[model samples]
Target: MSPTTDADLSDFVFVRRNDGLPIEEIPFELVERKGVGHPDTMCDAIAERASRYYSQYCLEHFGRIAHHWFDKVMLFGGESDLDYGHGELVNPYTVLFAGKGAHRCGDTPIPLADILRRAAADVLSEVTTGFDADRHLVIDCRIVDHQGAGRGRSRYRPESHDDLVAIGDPSLVSNDCNLLHAFAPFSRLEQAVLRIERLINGPDFKARHRDTGWDVKVFGSRNGEDFSFIVNMPFLASDISSFDHYLSRKAECREEVVGLLRDTLGGDPAVLFNPTDRNGRPYLTALGSVADTGDVGAVGRGNRVTGLITPMRAMSIEAPAGKNPLDHTGKLYGVLAQQLARRLNEMTGKPVETHLFTSKEAPLDRPDQVVVRVHGLQDGGDEEQKIRAVVAEALANTAELTREIIVTGVTMW
Candidate 1:
């Protein structure tokens, strides 16, 4: 049958079922309650620092043309899986980097492994005061051998043997304590998102984005269930009549999407939209969930007050634009960090610190169009109310700052 405006899209929607439970009844005590020194915290620090360093290095060396020479840098962080049955927690150490021209780092070989290891050690040392030297943290870097002995193809292959090197660890952690403790807060984020999705879309609404591919699965409470969402929106300039028509079309499409989502999973129906509309804006949304919640209650109930949702905006300025994209990204990130920290503190009635990162990628086709990635972090409490407030503030500030930047006519080419 031809797809109709009201036709259910459930067939296209994906579902993942498991014995895993939703975060609903999970006691709040199961979540870890530490502020810093958490594995996720450490990962955030490392990823931010590494991305910032890479961005700066590119700017200093390539100037306005840096984006043409850059690539993706994957930001990897988090702990190992926990073996609850065995009463052991395997604290997982991960290495994620992103950059442009990642496939062509075979020439002018850079010591990527060394850089990653150093970065990890520095991060660990900075986070862990008086860390036990006896507990040696093994940090290794190696190329991802995806092709099984030449039988498979590598996901990322350097164009020249002299390009940059790829580094990571193969030894996954194996432990007994609830490794979930290390990732409880993140789990809460997942729960909040899932609840919201189900409320607006339906219970069957599954996350459609992943690191490797576009796969859809229901939010679960088990290993490999952490959820994250990314929304990409575009602004357009059009007549009011056209804009109304566009909104109508968007609303119809959104309803169909949510209807299909509910049919697949049996969730409640709800819709979330930006309070303000943008002209010609295209949006992308991503979701992730955690599988375990060992200390959910201890940390705090997943209240909106303690949860936060923030968006980090990035723009690329091509060469000959009379500005450096890298420098501009750094400056913007700094501004975001400072502003977010102040705003979060005021909203939460608690002192807060913000983290920021800048990343660059080399243009494969357009040598002049440099791409800059900016990441920002804002702290929220463990309650739902607090989290929601933080997210609201962050989003408001981000939108304002983005508008200001565009109006100032700043360029980082």
Candidate 2:
């Protein structure tokens, strides 16, 4: 839906239906949430952190995040049995981290396998409730190198590779021509639900709501003034006793969430947790998440580039999470596209879609395509000139995009 923020529409294209209803005035809508426990998002977050931990390790020792590409990660969800408040995993996760990387710093082994496995354990613990990282799950971190315990091959044998050749490499550029966008003051409902999830998942929140697992997902929708949210969060069986007790705990969590949403959105919004489950059976996690059950997840299936799979708007399906933080356009341009969109919208007060495309090995700033689409923007108008100037300035400021991505961690989906 389009934004309702008041703006001068004199030079804008006022798009309206025959009924004269704005885009946000849809009578009905559908929104889905991919929980943090969901297989795909779990994989995405783990993979992202894998790169991040490695990047930090590299920067600390080698002065930069050396050549590591881990886009081939896979999450294998295991099976579990649950009745009421008790559940147990019969088969735990068979998570495999496979990909290419430079796993050495001048003969000093970087401990790639250890780092990736630690990354998995850290992420799994953070994303779930009562799951034991060392006992409840099986993790296999394999690097593509001729080393201790990796899978394939590293970049020309990590032992004797030219370190300086890999570092500050010009070929360390975007690998794909991508189109990314950002919401300038993002959608209100989006911000509200995300904030609510983080609030409920915080250590302070968990100290109170023990039944509320860390794997939280919030799906927000609006029908004009009526807003509602469907959250899919796994309830920890260790904290819950019976199905009735589980429901009661779930209700308490929902009530707390509803209060948060109501205050933020300034209206009463319906909040439901695990709405599709029956009374006798619900999403009760033996390990504090649905991943211990029959749910299978992949890398790119969870969130869009914006971190939420919002289908109603123009978005990139590129799984920016866990991709190479330095060179991959899927990660670098995800930030770039968002920056471009935000700046354009801030200057013009118009719904803008900023698209910048760059091929492999090309300069990140010198995009082959720099196209900005503004709603109601006329071609060759003075307003268009201002918009172009704004885009140019933003693009000029992106010389350090890669540095920012690796330093701050790639934050898109």
Candidate 3:
């Protein structure tokens, strides 16, 4: 990809609606501070960690046997402020996972469910802490069987499978007192269906319309010739002044913001935009990429998945009398989170999931703000280094734009 300096800013400018409501940028600390122990954060961390571990297991153990093998996985979290009477619920958050992979033999093929489950279990074991084993840590694994005949000696055959394996289980041991018991005997196919349902019917789906007052939008697509990808961008005000302020301080906070973006949006560089009509507003853009295969069998062989996850500290749009003034600050952030997820999916040719979280409290210092954090897990031995390396690089690149915005006081709406 060309550097930002190389590209003409004119083509990249993104305009908002005619209304004066320009999008705004939110601090990463507000969204990512949920801490590692939070249920939602733990779920996301475990699911991705497990999926990656499983993928490596396949590559190491089955690479010699299968002609091709790979996996696509995603993690999501959600919460309702209405559940708690006053402040937002802090500890009991929901986490979800969707994963799929394929393996081919010379003529015969094997389902990868067994390997996926073991990997998931391994990840859960490594990450679970503080919470009771029975009530904390839930695992869901999905496997799609895409087995068929080879078109020709060199022709690619992208087969679509109808069979699925879905499994949901709790990482902790069972406790009688905990009513929120985990499911058992998880199936990979069932998990796949659940993931699809979330992609199409989850909260993010309801959050996509302009009238819905939602903060984000997500979209996705996949094909055999090319790899699957997801994109997550934000839609906000186009005023450049906000961008300027953000750029001015980018150096101080860029590392955390960019790191979060790369981890969430894949390796793609986050893009900042200035629409033609608005000289003062700016928005952020992110793209994810995947490989494309060539051959007759590869035609129409792909799965596109998109998910939107939004977490709000409060739902009331109107500020209460005699109360601290509400900021109404993070709505644009919710929207941007959705957009980034969609963009990443499109670019990578892989299934995509996006999440958004907001706080109702005007000043974020109040206990009302929702906190979120992310972590990764790897297989035993040498695999740990590889996972850390990928995550480290993503954090480094992600820091650039975030820091730039803070220091230069530049806004890319």
Best by lDDT: 2
- Cα lDDT for residue 301, candidate 3: 16
Q: Rank the candidates by lDDT, best first.
A: 2, 1, 3
Model 1, TM vs. native: 0.27
lDDT tens digits by residue: candidate 1, 69-144: 1112222332323221111113323444333222223343344455555655676554332232223244533333
lDDT scores in order: 0.29, 0.66, 0.25
Name the candidate, 1 or 3, with the larger lDDT value.
Answer: 1
How accurate locally is residue 151 in candidate 2, as Cα lDDT from 0 to 100? 24
The 10-residue segment of model 1 with minimum total lDDT is 174-183
TM-score of each: 0.27, 0.81, 0.25
For residues 169-217, write the lDDT of model 3, one tens digit per residue.
1111111110000111112222222233233223453244111111122
Going through the candidates in the order shown, the clash numbers are 99, 5, 96
Candidate 2 worst ten-residue window by lDDT: 1-10
What would the C-alpha RMSD of candidate 3 be, to one decimal place? 25.6
